[model samples]
Target chain A: MSESQQHHQSPGSPPASGLGLALFWVYVLLYIGFMGLVLVRPDLLSLRPFFGVNLAIVYGMGLIAAAFVLAVAYMVLRSGR
Target chain B: MLHETSIAAVTIFATFVLGVIGLSFFLGRKGQSASGYYAAHGQIHWFVNGIAFAGDYLSAASFLGICGMIAFSGYDGFLYSIGFLAGWVVALFVIAEPIKALGKFTFADALDSRFNSRGIKLSVAISTLVVSVFYLIPQMVGAGSLIKPLLGLPHEAGVILVGVTVTLIVVTAGMVSTTWVQFIKGSLLVFFCGVLTVLILGRGLAVNAGREGSENLTPQIRTVRPDGTVLVDGQPQSRDHDLRPVGTIIRLPERFAGQESTGPLGPLAYLATLEDSTIVTWATKKHADSEGVHTTYTPVERPGTELLKPGGFFKGLASGNLPDRLDFVSLMLALFCGTASLPHILIRYYTVKDAAAARKSTVVGIAVIGVFYVLTLYLGLGAMTSGALDPTDTNMAAPLLAKTFNETLFAIISAIAFTTVLGTVSGLIMAGSGAVAHDLVENVCGVRMTDHEKIRCGKLAAVGLGMVAMVLGILFRNFNVSFLVGWAFNIAASANLPALVMLLFWPRTTRQGIVAAVTVGMLASLTWILLSADTFEKVYGLSRDLALTPFSQPALITIPLGFLTLVVVSLLTPAPASLRR
Candidate 1:
């Protein structure tokens, strides 16, 4: 705990970051759900078109963007706490 | 003259190589101690280390193989980039902080932190070596494939060239040099690729009429004789080589029938216009007759609509074959779970100062990596219609796409591709050397060495691993690097991820349990891959039905088995008091 504010005291701080852990599960769930949809209903996944691209492309882009967003969100929450 | 070996390109590539090697020598003086050698004294800036993470992670497979795959097979290739980028999520949120907190030098250091068991150290050291070697093969193969066009050297020569060069970098300064090299390489790679993408958008899509509207994208054949000569389309390729460049839109939709191309379209408009058009994609079919091995490159015309779909590369998904579907699912599972599990990636945590720095660096890595992957979609599509693809070697897609712009752009891209391989191979060698010197010799074998001796031992290990990588790369030159990387991911996920996750989260994890899980996971995945249908058909030249494994990928079954073995063994044996909290 003393190592949180101090940069050079310890080798590394003990890991108790709940935000990163929580987001880990969140991202995992999202990925599983995405893959499941792709396997179960390929047609439905491809049916919805957005911005001249199909639902699959849209979803894939959304997933990548979500990863970046979630990572930033975790960073903010960690620093804020 | 477009695809011929260019003197200007070779000069540029030589300059880049000399600059990288010189940078390594300059940084070599800082790594005298073991900590500096292995972890860069934990002084690297979080942002620089973060970009370095991207450099180490991208490898040749991500830059060259994925782009080539997309240019040839369409959307299926982008799925790889997606799966790869998503894996960083696991690294950021789960592994980054805890791994930094627990380990000092190697991944084995983290797992063995609670219990100083020699068995655990020995098992983990061996596991790291196996994973690192598997990962090194593709990077070496990618270097081999890249050098052929860039310098007109044979593939085997390229493998040895990179192998020796990377070994020198690791041996000179260890992690200090490796980190900075990766940082410079990563930034250059992403920047140049972004530049290439902008150029792609500027030139726009074209129906390649080959200076005449009546031209067609025809199939070209290549025969490799026992004497090591290459005959292209039933004739000996000239001194500069014979296989002409390929990849183009042979036909447009009815609305654009009068025009040779839809010039200067926007990014979104490019995709929309491409969707309505018909493009020529090549497929290679091989036959071994009395003369020798003959491979025929066949051109297939497909609508842009179907090309944009996901079923081309992974045939099982579209064919509705249950076993094939299982293989696809398993490969994806591995990629999703593999990033944090990789030894080179794990060692990166130690390069930064603390857990917070590690976290920040991971966040930075994910952002850079994510953006690059999105750009791959544009680059791949741009290359698919670039009109400079070499139908025989899909790996040449990105460089060839740059060639469409100018000779200078092509030279820069190829040199950067080679740098991509160098940066990744150095990191992997560093990991392998650490495993050998720190874990195997010192901790496991109970050999005491001075600080100076440890560095010497690590350097020896790097040289040995580099030689092994060179041999394997030459042997497996025919396989696509992305596909080889998938096997590496599957093995890493199965062998390492289970033990890592359990040790961090589960209080009941025993040292014995970890040793068992790693050994079982590593051995099982390797065995499964050896007996897989794909390996039988491709490597052994046997019928697919004769393969022992039901599917090619081992992650679907092996990953769970790793967890199961760990949990069951931990329960059966009581946790040692030394390990208990």
Candidate 2:
């Protein structure tokens, strides 16, 4: 219980490197943007429909693409740093 | 289904199991101490811990159950994929670092951090054990399902096998072996599923018009009347009748409905469906036996395509209007929120070294999990058209689809399915053991036990929980593996997530508030599930239509209730003055 009191890095702290913060924000914005796209255009979200159930393929793919974009952003940001 | 177990499959299965046992023994050494046994001394490498996250998280539910659901249900099935993946986002951004920075052993440590209330420990520990056991049942049931088909053994033997192996894993090394085993299983699952998906895309979708229906076309029907006596055809069918056969699917002469590619669907084509055509779906009911249960069928015919995709199981959920959409949304919400909140999954974060590693590992876990989920669509669609669907047992759809491609592939997948059970069950046992030894015995009871005593107590607890899991697995042998998982996710999301999230983010969260929220949330949700019509008819042998809840899943009702309880209760009780520090 005593060990629990030690102040660790607050969960909201920037990553150790300055560039990690840039990359993190980039990812956050991209994801939020993708989610916005989904919200605005629900039609883009429905790929496979059987029995009126829209498969969230559009949503899943959008997320994956955003993930890749984030990865690339991290790499580029890190390289520049 | 009759293919003999080959040397390759046996070798792969045996090697994996033996390697797992060896890893257990190695990790099990330091685990002789209590901290080592329960939480791996809270010193695992971040990278290893991260992959183990993938391992521990991707249970039989992910691999067999979801894939089966997707293969049978079409787009609605993929909704689960998205929900589950979204949960990791919540975990990574919101929970990972905070959980690692604060807690040790059980989730109760983090919740009870401000006030060393015994009540918090007791309630959260009970919630942890209850959720862990609910989750463990499906893993054990899946093990039985996999083993019966894999080694030609009975369901009882499979359950016993998992129980024995998991108990040994827990009793011997605890979290150390559990983490490594999960790491291995997780890695192999992602890799192989990737390979299978590629193979599926390469093979492409073709109509096997030559296939003929079997003599009976018996359809393995279950008819549920107003009273829930499940009957096959006109007679009552016992769950022990696992030997039922389903109707054969013959593909009509048109192209595959959901394909974006000309040859076969690469990973991209599967996702590229909404660009052109609107997916059409309709539902029909078939009567089985003397019971009057209605089966929803998705007539998989695309608008212009002659080839029809037969959507089983959840086809009804897709076509219906607002109420149906709510059911879909509720299920997705449970999955998205549930992943971060599962007790078994959260404990794995402790197994890693520091907060940074936990975050990094979560990132890796998301990457790996995301890729695997994408592959599921390919696998499910492959099975749907491969003429290998068991309408009676959607859980077997993926493996049977693999068999349609190659017997050897089928063997490998089956063996992997068993390991899927192993990895998940081991993590669950680790969670349960920690709840008993770390939270209940040592923390609440204020036992002055040595490290050795702690480890010893945990081993005993593991044995007890494993036995309980074994019996439940055997008793509930006939339930669909995926359906049961919904219950697990609902309970975990309701009981645990609210408390964990509020404690981490809100400074005013009091010990009494946490305890009450957990107790009420857990009991209320469990009661709702049991009293619901789905449970009465499906689980307790009562009438589904006669039950109270419109739907079986409690996520829509219970998750919000849990959050509100925590908020309201915390507002009412001020934190203790000493606890402000």
Error of 2 at B80 (Å): 0.9
Model 1 regions more than 4 Å off: A1-16, B1-3, B209-211, B239-241, B254-257, B578-581
How high is the TM-score of chain A in each model? 0.76, 0.42
Model 1 reproduces what portion of true contacts? 0.43
Model 2 residue B281 lDDT score: 29
I-RMSD for candidate 2: 7.7
TM-score of each: 0.96, 0.83
Query: Candidate 1, residue B577: CA error in Å?
Result: 1.6
Report interface Cα RMSD per prediction.
3.2, 7.7
lDDT of 2 by residue, B1-581 (tens): 22245667667667767777788887777776766787888888877787888888888878888887765555546556666776776677667767777777878887776677899999989999999989988888888777755676777998998899889887888888888888888888888898888887776544341244322323334456768655555466555542233222332223445433336554555334212332322234654444366564443344312111212344333254444445555666687678878999888878776665676677778788778877876776666556555565567877777777777888778777777888899999888888898889999899979888888888899999999999999988877777788788888888888888777656667777788789887998899888886679768887666887766678888888988898888888887564555
Candidate 2 residue pairs in clash (backbone atoms < 3 Å): A51-B281, A51-B319, A53-B318, B28-B173, B223-B291, B223-B293, B224-B292, B224-B293, B233-B289, B300-B309
